[model samples]
Target chain A: MANPLEATVLVLGEQSEIFLGLLKKHFSTIYQLAHIENKEEFLKDNGAEIIAVATSNNVGMSKEMIDALPKLQIIASFGVGYDSIDVDYAKQRGIQVTNTPNVLNDCVADTAMMLTYAVARQLIQANTYVKKGQWTSSFPLTTSLSKKVCGILGMGNIGEAIAKRAEAAGMEIIYHNRTQKNHVDYQYIATLEELAKQADFLILALPSTGETQHIINANILDKMKPSAYLINIARGSVVDEKALVESLKNRQIAGAGLDVFETEPCTESPLFEMENVVLTPHYASGTHETRLAMAELVCENLIHFFNKEPLVTPL
Target chain B: MANPLEATVLVLGEQSEIFLGLLKKHFSTIYQLAHIENKEEFLKDNGAEIIAVATSNNVGMSKEMIDALPKLQIIASFGVGYDSIDVDYAKQRGIQVTNTPNVLNDCVADTAMMLTYAVARQLIQANTYVKKGQWTSSFPLTTSLSKKVCGILGMGNIGEAIAKRAEAAGMEIIYHNRTQKNHVDYQYIATLEELAKQADFLILALPSTGETQHIINANILDKMKPSAYLINIARGSVVDEKALVESLKNRQIAGAGLDVFETEPCTESPLFEMENVVLTPHYASGTHETRLAMAELVCENLIHFFNKEPLVTPL
Candidate 1:
């Protein structure tokens, strides 16, 4: 059913089946390049025909990959974070870049709150103890997360969402970011270290950026109270993994709840052996409903680009 | 080392070390009956001089135990729920009863909200997969908890606290209680079954009583949406463990988060092996700060009773 008039779309990496099915309806040729075993050769064979690049945040556009597809007109990514995509290079080439935003704020903020409670309550350890029949002999008390100060690292849309949730749970809200957020009534601490000092739980929710890199390293970790917890739902690049491991190992801080890691597929880490840490794969916004919405938005961005309509959410 | 004028208090069961330390400061003749090898012989040996009985909710005053303590003046319990204590028998014997309340509402409600998120997101399963390195291959998306109806089984203080937290997490609040709550705007579903049918999460926070025992039995569980979650932070006896097990096993309901069990020190149960259930071994109110506050209140009640002053929280 090649329409011949419709443009070609080159899916740069892994895309959900639902997204592919929807994209196929709009475009004449939708070649998922990842499905091909020889993707490098496949891209070279089809590079001349690829008018657009379809990918997710994880498989972001790079200079070399974009250079291969000289005819690339647009890049539609499937997440809020366009840090992975080479947006500057695409803009220089007169290519339009779009992303799915505002849609994932709810689920990601839910995860941040979930992690905050999970770590503070020692939930995973408590579950393990009950499963192992240790409660029959002894049970230890955990710290209460309610009525404590929750320091958010970023005061973006997601951070505001988390604050609303935390405040409703009876926790005081404080935040540290590059600049103060207007409209929010929460207390603002200028420095990350000061925010760490005031909080019982320090939650990281900032985007991955050069300026924000290692924002929570040893210096900031040391400033945190020994009774406090660390929760990261944002990118792992914001935290110094080695420093966090050392701090957790030495009991410099209480514990952590991590959904992302410094490296993907974190097969080996000292954190895995620690009882205090609650770890999850990079799936903070990975909800059945939210992911489908994001996938649809990804398709919509591309379709709008082809239809000469204004992009729904252009980066 | 002993205050001769102080009342002789009989310690009924094993107490926490922190609670014991605080109790020892006020009372002179604190005879810990649990330390005795033969409790029957010990009661017979030294039951006459016991002016007051100091115990927790688990080793509550029974009719038989009350009959033995002919000189008992007051019973100071260490937890909010005095369901285990024979209040009627105590009243008949003119023995005053006091319990710790209000101090644990925040932590207990936090547990309710935590359980809600844990079960809905399949948090425990997600953590296991990431820890086991299965994330390297694949990870499935979880269900979103936001924008769902959270049905609180009882609109008591703890349930209200849970409502506030759930609302902050972007959930609609529905409630089923004996009567409608005043000063709140949340929807009220008259029947428990109706509430269960409308809810995405049904959290149990009702006090355990003769009227409430097995309140969430088969019929109510069956009325619930198959995709909904059950969160029990109240007494475990309210839920029929056997019926819940059956529903979960057959996938009649999606999942459950249980903080208490019918028989604690539950050494054996099919629940321990279930993937969809998150068990926490009666640790809902197990927070260091809250327990300390509860412990302090227990001591204060005894002190007030001995001083011929009014009890702080009399039942």
Candidate 2:
């Protein structure tokens, strides 16, 4: 068995200082992928010694990178989503994978509710109106979220949390999932088309998979009510950005509140110029409290894997 | 008794078309205060014929204005708050007062929660950052509202509604009212100072009264944690604007989410420049759905008053 303290762990991306400190506490040899100027030479010389890899959803390990790490035993991701990581390839190699889930559910759910409220209530535009000395005149009345339908896609733990908050806001919940969930009493719509047609706010909370990529295409967009809002806190690939841009341009949908995009760290997009949409930089789970918990969980998973114990949240 | 359709109603301010339509349907003689350029002359000629006054919280009936109309039996206001109206003087004259209250609770509560989530999560700024093509870098982690103390002042219907949403968001609810109520399970802090000191978000949801004016002065603001936020969905007079400005300037409090202002339609203030605050133009219940309900209720109260029935929502 590899010595837990001496095992080389390759950190693939920039992480919080706290996460790095925790990683250092558990392992002596920590190699940052960014620090390696000649990656090919570095992997040739030292990749054999790298027993573990640490990454996040944004900076996922690729198949080529996985192939380079001959002795990679585990891939511990810092976020709930592992779609970016080649999980199937890792599984085929008998390597384990773990993610920091449940810890981020609250923050992500809060983001969904926040986005829904912001878009429906015109919070950002209203604030800007006030700041611009436009309050001297009566501001236009906005749409109310209360007593409206909140159609959730992917009725998972995070979606359930979002539903709880939405219900408290007096919104009725309906959802669409591959299989109906018995635990929740919220009405289940059989198809995405029905959910889109009925929803005042269609929130995307599903994972990113090959099947889910571009799930919200032009056809789905056309089914949504012109007054309905699209709130995406899920993986960006779930939505076809081109179709969304076209929808917004033509006023096919009222607006969107997006925390994720097809290409993350998206510097420019047509959505930026549209006042109807509210965009966040893929920051659904970005909070001081939640990030600390998620980072701690990632470290724990890595530590537990090296100790040959059960993984905290193995996928 | 005056004929139901013939009784004259003097509408004191601009109103929604729906409200005006309803009023016109009930009363044949409907006089708009704005159209009467010579109000004193017009009142001298026709005030005795005015059986009832229809006004709004913004344009309230003053003592002098009430005195002008000798036959006035009731004042029907279009909003929940009646602080702008001289209720005591009207009561002394044996005149009844009515406001649209219960109809607007949900939208106002929704606004309170929207402001809270927006301020705590930095939603507005985050949205702007992404729009400004600044998403190439990681956005800053914001404070989370979950597991934090939400201190409410004035636990009325709207306050209770706000508490419900806050609870769903995973916040611990504490409140300070004039006296502790037996109906609620939330902890009641007898004093305002203690609640301010303990709260992560100090939300003001009380009615505006003489005794409550400037209640959140420098002393109360000074008692608040620097990390705590102030959310005022109640009347603006409930807070001392000058004191709040000073507190925010000095970083004594984290931020504020203001839906009302001391002097409304206020075009200029130091707060306009502050990025830490989220300001709305006194539009808490300013949704098309809620405003229509409020307007209809105002009309109903007027109809009920002239018909010798109980007022829909008597103040």
Candidate 3:
């Protein structure tokens, strides 16, 4: 006598053990896999009916994998970014794709502000100095946010949140989004170049797509003030890594605080060698509270689907 | 004729070279005789009428130096911690004492939130593993901050600000202050012990004073939830460093995020050896914009005093 709730769940992305454990609680016979390069192996062995894919910009699922899953009814993503899972492809197969959105807004926003603070105050560098016993007399006097301009690119939920925190710190807020948001207090600009030229601190919060690729390149970097700082908590591909490295090297920009990079598990990036850059391994929505909420949301979405209920925060 | 503005200023404490350059812009004579173990040697060489002292808990100004400065009319301390400076002595001598107060409030609050996010998500530890080239495979599992109580000690300006940010993150706010503040919308507790026992995360935002010393001791730690975390961005002396080290060591507490310590240049502290604690050199308000504003405030105070006007933030 098999349980009526038994569903074969395929988890494609890595999650916190807590989250993974929670997923197992909801769905029976759960199979976990990270970057399933061999699609044939997954299809032949697991017999997955419902796939829950955890997507990041670094690791994405291929189009071929979707076609092979005969019993796949839903492609549940753990996060807002479905750039990993081909939405159009999944839609064509009568497969419903869902993502957890609006849950990570504050966490991502907090991370943006944290990166900005980390770079402006030299927290990471100072900690490193203290750890390395490099205290000759004192640490170099770092910058403050009392009179700085915080330029936010992509005036979405995360950008707005970062602006709120930065504004509370007495920073003048200016933003450059694709379209001007209505009834906003922040000064909006049409072009990234115009925003870069004006801002002392530029934050990239735009989603990554074809139009956004290499958005922050040599031409844009040239427009930025010499003392300006760049922070990217968004997708890594939105920035030109080589131009950023060159700008930091030539002192064209004061520094950069990067959470994401062109590659994940960044082992040998030139940006790491530069002291001006604070490199984090793309952990914008990384918080205990936020992650749990995200996991619960994923679980709720799966539960609703199984019970024939409407999706909450559908992609 | 000598320029009337050519003033000799006695500088105290450690300053960033950039900030020093800013100070030099206003005053002609900058006497940087920091760490003057020999009071007589410092006073004899620098015949300055105004002294700017910046002292932390470790390196404070001695009573002897204050007596030696016969012509000193103003003693402008570097930071808000005028506890190191004998304000009463200066007041008795009809000397004005000014400290940088409101300028640094926002930055400190920002750092508090930064530590809160970093610890909650295990960003520092996760990043450390990735940086050390230990990422053999993807490991997923992180703590979430949803539906948790954040107990704050000392609901001052910074604490209130942290509360606003925490509330935005959907955390339940409980606080213990000397007296309840009317402006904030948070649950108030009469004592820290009550707050500590209930909170999933206990944050120390109280000042370091005689009455508040070692307030978060072993007894208090014993009462706190075993899964709870402790964060201190306030003065280090407010929490018992030894008790905290043992709490984390014995797994009595989940983790700690500390910016300040019982001692500065805290190289030999046992907390550093543990993986459960996230330690940063006392740099809650170490942002460049904030530092410059503080420096400007100091310069303005000196200007106002010399002109026979009231000080901006006089003690």
Best by TM-score: 2
Q: Give per-residue CA lDDT, model 3, range B198-283, as digits (tens).
A: 99889888877788889889999999887899999988888888888888888999898888878776776676566666777877
Mind giving the per-residue lDDT tens digits that candidate 1 earns over A1-315?
A: 435337788887777766777778767887887778998888778787787778988889898888888888899998888788888999999889989887888888888888888888888988888877778765778888767999999999999999998988778999988899889999999988899999899999899998888988999999999988999989989999999999999999999999889998788888888888999888888888888889889878887888889999998
Candidate 2, which CAPRI tier?
high
Which residue pairs does candidate 2 place in steric collision? none
Instruction: Tell me the lDDT of model 1 at A92.
Output: 98
Q: Name the regions of candidate 2 deviating beyond 4 angstroms.
A: A1-7, B1-6
- Give per-model TM-scores: 0.94, 0.97, 0.85
Note the chain A TM-score of all models in turn. 0.94, 0.96, 0.90
Candidate 1: clashing pairs of residues: none
Task: Please report, in order, the local distance difference test score of every candidate based on alpha carbons.
Answer: 0.87, 0.92, 0.75
Deviation of model 3 at A241, angstroms: 2.6
Sorting all predicted structures by TM-score, with the top scorer first, yields 2, 1, 3
Interface RMSD against the true structure, candidate 3: 3.1
Q: How well is candidate 2 docked (DockQ)?
A: 0.86
> lDDT tens digits, residues A1-315, model 3?
223356656777565676787777777767666657875677786645445443433345567767667667677777777666777887887777777778888768767776787677776666666565554455666676766899999998878878877876668999999899996888999988999999989999888887899999999999999989999988888999999889888999999988777877677766756666666666666666676777888777877787889977666
Report, in order, each candidate's fnat. Answer: 0.71, 0.90, 0.36
